[model samples]
Target: MHSFFRDSPEFEQRKRRPYSPPKVTLAQVRSAIPKHLFEKNTAKGCFYVARDIVCAVVVYKLGWAIDPFASTFGIVSVAVKWFLWVVYWYAQGIILTGWWCMAHEAGHGTLSNQNWINHVVGFLMHTFLLTPFYAWRVSHHAHHKATMSVERDENYVPRTRKDCGLPDELAAKLSDYHEIFEDAPIYTLLRIAVMQVFGWPMYLFTNAMGSPRHPPYTNHFLPWSSIFKPQHCNYILISDAAIGAMGYVLYLWTCQVGFAYFVKLYLIPFLCVNHWIVMLTYLHHCDPTVPYFRRKQWSFLRGASSTVDRPFLGWAGRFFLHNVSHDHLSHHLFSSIPFYNQPLVTEHIKKVLKENYNYDSTNSFRALYRTFTECCFIEDDGDIVFYKNKNGKTARVLADDALDAPSLH
Candidate 1:
């Protein structure tokens, strides 16, 4: 029976499969990389922050110059003016997002080896964008510490059918076939739009997609929330004060300029920052093939490997977002690695992990649609589980037994 099984076509197919985990330890993976890659150059990191800040300022000024006549073009139609404003918003937003990524690096202590510099730069960049720097830094640390753990991950926790509390009829409509064929494209687009526009704010205010923890509500801005400890209350208050000061500044600016002009210059671009952030994070962790692990099977390596890297808006996207989307796995593995060094580290990771590496080079919009449509709710209880469509069909499941199989090497 063993001989016959070995000779079967199924055995041949299994032998030809490409995906498998690395046989090496995390320390081994680290040892294989060049030691110099870990060295943080404060000057170089500050240069990047300065460059992004200057570019963002230039873009902001350009938009300000164009604002008054933005709607006054006689040769251009209203639609054209609207399109130009959109382009302006997107341009400024992408640059702002780059600043946000720099702050993110600061949070990871990659902006510079100096803790004070990282904190100072991170606080300023994040406050300008209205994000609570310390609050986000602490929570994001939790996210990295518990990436794919269903019980502890800090962001983008998928809901199950039971958790969603969807009525039977509504749940039935979310079935695989209905979502693809029966549901209107407009409905899906609208849902995506809502998520892009309001998801970040909602998460900050209500911790809408955060881990299911005690007290039922976990806000990022609140120190008393379960997301932070009592010791963090002081930093949270500082963050709130920073945000309040920025708001007051904006209010003073708006009082000088018209509210409409302020909205055009600042509010629209700010929304774009939120949109990019939400879309980037949502797509990073929400792939169908990625498994959410329960405590029984959870490990740091496993959790980190569960994230997939995606390309957004092509080269421009990578540039503006500081390769955050493209090299996310590397960032997850070594949070303190600088953005400039991420690509080099990521290549090394891919070489070591080989088939275990997960990268989806799909167009951003298509990937977004695929995740929203297929990667919905997951099973609450599982050693490993893929998300399921509304109809209760498993969207995608990893080959756990095979991944757990003995290393080919």
Candidate 2:
């Protein structure tokens, strides 16, 4: 159909037929692009290697800062070093985010000419993040293959307002919070922070805040039988061990160096990285107008077309999301392409899709605000739902048994 975010005259015509995007054939996609753009070898390798070296240096520097007892001026040197450590922590997030993107490229089998290299890099990157490398690889691969199909889309699937089951009162209440918190910067920040530190762990143990589309698979990372799969649990434990060991060592040094400098320089920046990861993932797929398709009507192309690109953030998106956000449609179209090449391939596809190509270059702040207020706690038609107004009084909408079709318009 037409771009759901905006209402244009062209959108009106598409609305008449409820447009279904054309099937994106491999030949068509390939024919529209230049052959040279698909090459996998180059500067991306150097970048990845540089990141590994930098992460190594940060760890080394932190290790060197462990002076259990030192003079006043010596302590000051330690403080400055710690401040640099914090800066390095922030840099780590950006670096790790890039590494995560690379792993995603591996998921797409795009990191190198060889598929095995992609798997190796993807597994290591995800494992370090305490994610189940193979499992997430499988699920994310499916997500690209079925980007917005309701029955198969992996994450952030939207429901029509009518499908929403909340009674007027409950629906009002849900919408009220949705109004206040859905896109609030503070709220988003808190959610991201909480999720980063605890989200994966919680999702692992409890399956909270995961994609409904995944169903029984939503809890994929959990060890139903054993908790120590190599990439799933063992690697995370190792990571935790490293962090914990460093934290303990830092604590010992703080006895002489002072607590004020320690917290300010190291802990805060460590916290910020979690914030970035959670926020980036949350913002990517949670669009108000993006739809999920059922298997009967779903195709690879329509699912891919469901994604929208953001501007200003697109560069970071490419770096952090493995270029999944920039030319996201191509990602859905061909998950095997490498991250460095996605933009080139995306530009090519845009020409073919023409007006059908969807990109939202709106200010993310405004878009985020709008998304928060208008979009939250959506339900399918025929369910008991609740919402409350500013006064906390309930507003009734539909009964539990009432059957109604979802409204896309």
Candidate 3:
């Protein structure tokens, strides 16, 4: 029975194997793309911002007007109303997430050719959304620099069993889900839920699930936190002040319109933005197929190649998320590449890299489930390590032994 389960179609499909990076250089990959694609248009970038903002406003107002009427019907009507409202929230969230991505572009200075324009736009967009522009910019730069380095990457750093800090027995049990939940579906579903809903805020506030290099008290919002240097203190304070101002504005709005109105109009959509942020970043970097490198084995190209480009909601998702999901590997490769050009860049790289390229067309839901369950923690001992399941087996091993294969120039 166990052997049959292992050979099952679902198990085989979700399994991921390690991929070796190509010997091709970034210069060679960049030269393959058309030079015109590198151009950034400030007007075009602002158009996207304008379009998403207008759409978000429409969705918010529509939901606000319909919500009271939806509540007036029967229990079924209330359910339907809520269902519609949640859909609107999701739409609004996607638009706001687009704004967040625009700010992210500003951080990379890819939103426009002008550096000052990037900063000005990034600060306003991020601050309005309660993110500290410069604070997040510095840390995000570090994340891009380190990528999948186990010791240095800022976010989504997985824990080794010993590093997890759970009591020994509980750690062992949680690590090996086969021994605990076994065939129970609820355990998998519940774990994904917790990660999606709570992960982002926890990372921002407590630095939870961040680099182990950081002290236990580390937080993104604190100027003195280990994540930043003293030089960054002023910017961190500015970020906090921006967030505080937004919080005060929210408080005033709640006082004016009541708490429930605020929850429906802004809070739920805000949570949805967090959800997209967590889910996309998690899926991009964490996979059974991807390996994390310690200092000795790490290189920028290797670390950047560790990411996988995934599709969300097809073209609509690509448009809304500003190609962040589909062209992620290219973004990592050339952090300055504008989102408008990333798809073209990715295509060029894919053709040039051929077998060395990593693209996963797996269903997003399936990939999420598999990643959450299978990518529990990596073995701490190896210089280059793949994620291991509870049974001490690697989650997925390439059939060709490609992980040990030599690079081809």
Candidate 4:
């Protein structure tokens, strides 16, 4: 995608064509990348994990060290304290996010070739963030396999025009949108704010914004929540236990250090991590130009390549965030390729993919705002679908004939 959003009326006339099956196979995609890039370096993975841990500890120490200096200082003491605390929070939060990226790699089996080691590292790192690793791993793996499939992708599935209580027909003119639909900027702001803070937990607890095919109240915690199979039940229980144990540890830490300190040390950073997580995931897949596929129209190649790759936070993002956003397209195609190796893999795959690969360096905040408002509901029909705005205007259009893009489901 050259840009994340489009305002042209020609988009409606020039309906974007659905992807045909890739000219190359998965084996071909694998072959195009250098062999060494695929090597799962256990030592390198551990080193990254250790480095993140050390950074986190340093940030924690720096935060704790701030108070004594603040107290000893003269007139600007309170102001300095507040500013320092903000800096600490920012540093601490980003470092914690680095851990999240490593855990994500572990979940994807990119951390190590040894599956058990991946499990242990992933479980520990995610539990530190209060996430249920195996449970989320199950769905995340599913998402990789079916990235942009409307019925199968694990999260941020779009509602249909009908589902949004809008008419089936595309709006006659984009200009007439105000009278046609409820356009409440304040409500959108309120929704975005809530999602920024609580979206991750809400999704885990209630499967919020998950695929609509799953039953209501489907969750990541329960094995029988429709997201998991009977085989996954034991893993689900283990994840639940890990989360409970982490919660208790936090409680104990609070008791020892005082709740205020606990809040400063952990809770603030945790919230920042959540915000970044939500941003990364949402911006990757939820956009007007991105396509969602039905069974017949979908292939592993199309599903994997359909999403956007963004440069979030620039060099700081690559450093603290493990290049997860920077090389997401290649990551989806080959989840086992670690972030460090993804550049080579990405370049090779981009050659194979040609125009299929998407990289947008649109400022994340701008991209988020555009995506949140402009990418709303898709048409209820079509095997290949693109999002329509709240105004019932589509950024790109596909043929209206049901026969052209017949539902395989």
Candidate 5:
């Protein structure tokens, strides 16, 4: 097996140059891909949306039918029923996730060239998933603009050594921040569990990984929150109202169906969707080898360069996730390019960026765990810095030649 920090031969071979800012310009990135991929096919986008919805409905109805018809096999065991329930939730969750990604496409203006049409579809589908569409779209736009920027990137921002309360004296002495309690393996497990289950809601409600520049307790729901301007207050309120309406509908459904049945039918799959989305976004930008930039040394291309393209969930991910994680670097570079068109764009992007392109083929679930444990904190200051683990060691070293003058900013 490879080292947990992933000093894999493939990674080393791909990156002949040490980490530095991207040399590719936005114009160069755009010109690398074919022009037809940039076109938005509204009808094609609608077909995908409809297909996902139909699949979800079929899964839901067939899943319910299992209970009544189980006796046809001569008294189904409780264990068997439980297994089937798990399978149903997994299937249902994936279908809905595909639908969710289509709405995400709308947010990027790739669902259709018609802005109003995109907004309407995004609003409805995101509301169905109980996410605030406009709020997320607005914040997600900010995330893309400032990705990998230590001072400005919106989510999954690495905790700095000072932010984690590591002692400056001890860190300087041993280059380690292994606090007695926090460095324990048991503690890491607990942290990962809590993050996987609660991270999404925590971020949405409290902006957990949001910029520190925001006032304390800033959240996605508030119109006046520091993440938004006064001019965008109406959009924020509309998103909040849509969420409220969706919540009310779910509550009524829960009352009608009863709690246990509701959990089996809806809540379990919804939880899975949350888990998948959180893991996708988190693993894309968080890795031991990935560098996070301080704004003084930041550029759009450099920030985009910092992300890794992961083959999360293999073929299922392609079909169910619209290649959101698999072709993520291309998405970062050309966000308006539709998901269906991203594969070709990604191929050219990898060619253009070459050593700057990062693709980690690690199993997504294992990679998620590895990242959570190893990508702990960055130095309190540096124009470009990679994550350090509890022992304060970086998985990859920056070459002397790669260092640029801080004054270059």
Candidate 6:
């Protein structure tokens, strides 16, 4: 990979001189989010909590349906029932995702007025999904406070070509995009599912990886950005205990109801929630145009609200993902406004921010696939550059050269 970049003239042209830096300022982006919206509070956060309760009830009902029907069925009928189980699995994913969103609201102190109420709700909701509630809450809030900051961002920092420790075998493999995707997808899934629950704990406990900056705080529930201190540690343990309790209950259910039926009808849907989570954050941050700031250019407001919006998914965004879509800019700004009021205020802020407000109505799934395939690694000049490869089509290489490789991230 180094040889390829070094040998190619285009790489030399695209290689960064010294970083010139971006023109946009933190004050400018902060100014875009209206002050009133930042302060706005709403009861709708309760609606999301209620929705999760309702969705769980519906899922339980569906579980009852699947179990009885599967048991009564013949071999072919059982196969058919299991196939229906896949659909239920998807529904379970959505529901768990919704529950996670509510718990996230609790993290943001949006689900209720009281701080203790938020902690209790978040702990309960996230524990069922095997997520460390306080741990995730702290990291995620840090993500908001430091969104696009390349150095400070909590999640999804894109590694530059120079930074990639690509050995010859891996470099040769990367030469063919297929091998990289094949390798990356496995890691991506593990990251999206296993890492958030398990890896999150290690980061909190050991200060290993994907760890939040440890802020000095006397209170775990109160708003103090940039650190995950000892005070919040108990909440994560509480979350783990809840998971242990749930596991024991599941064991009882398996014994009474039978393991095959238990897994088929109940567990599959529960795991699907991870899909929504993986997709949500991926699409939220991974736009072609989104800038990842270096430390000098980074600031709290710019980092907080630098995220873009997806079209049509707004309600679902708020409901299943907390008010991330609507209240996001304000969430970035204040970090205190509850999720329920986020949307109405976000819209109001958008009206105020106008062109300065970042949003993308473009189809996200298509873009996600394209970027995942094309922009896994970035090439840096003085500025960070994402490039599209030229495959005999008319191309836009920044320096107007037809190099064998085009830069991308």
Clashes of each: 0, 28, 0, 1, 0, 7
Candidate 2's residue-wise lDDT over 217-277, tens digit each? Answer: 3455443313234545554444445445655777787886688656644455445545555
| TM-score, per-candidate, Cα-based | 0.88, 0.64, 0.88, 0.90, 0.93, 0.69
Error of 5 at 227 (Å): 0.6
Best by TM-score: 5
What lDDT tens digits, residue by residue, belong to model 1 across residues 264-326? 989999998999999999988987666787776677877787687776767976777888989
Residue 227 in model 6: lDDT: 51
Query: Taking the tens digit of each residue's C-alpha lDDT, what string does model 3 give over 1-409?
Result: 2231233333345354335556677677778888888888889877887887787778878987776778778778878788888788878888888888889988999878889889888888888777788888988999999989899998788788566433354345544546543446886798778778777778888887788888885788888888899999998898899888988999999999999889888888888888888888898898777778777767787788778887765786788888998999989988887898898899888887675566777677777777777776776666677776555457655444545534321
Better candidate number, 2 or 3, judged by lDDT: 3
Which candidate do you rate higher for lDDT, 3 or 6?
3
Runs of candidate 4 with Cα error greater than 4 angstroms are: 1-22, 170-182, 398-409
Model 6, span 21-58: residue lDDT tens: 22345455446655654452335555666777888788
Q: So what's the TM-score on candidate 2?
A: 0.64
How do these models rank on lDDT, best leading? 5, 4, 1, 3, 6, 2
RMSD in order of candidates: 7.0, 8.5, 4.4, 3.9, 2.5, 9.3
lDDT of 4 by residue, 1-409 (tens): 4344542332232235543435567788888888888888889988988999999998898889888889777898999998899998888888888888889988888888899988899899999999999999999888887888887888899887667666437444544444444458898788787898899999999888998889897889988888888999999999999999999999998999999899988999999989889989998898777678877788777778877888888888889899889888998888877889987888899898775677766678777877888887777777787787756666655444523533321
Give lDDT tens digits, candidate 5, residues 1-409: 6665564555556445466555667788778888999999999888877887888999999887877766555555566778789899988888888778889999998988889889988899889998899889888999999988999988888888888777773535353454522457787777877777677888888988777777767899999888888988999999999899988999999899799888999898988888888888999999877788886777788788778898788898888889999899999988989899998899999888888889988767778877887887888988888888777778777767555634121
lDDT for 340 (candidate 2):
67
Q: How far is 183's C-alpha from truth in model 3 (Å)? A: 9.0
Q: Once superposed on the true structure, which residue ranges of model 6 sit more than 4 Å away at CA?
A: 1-44, 67-80, 166-228, 231-233, 312-319, 322-330, 379-409
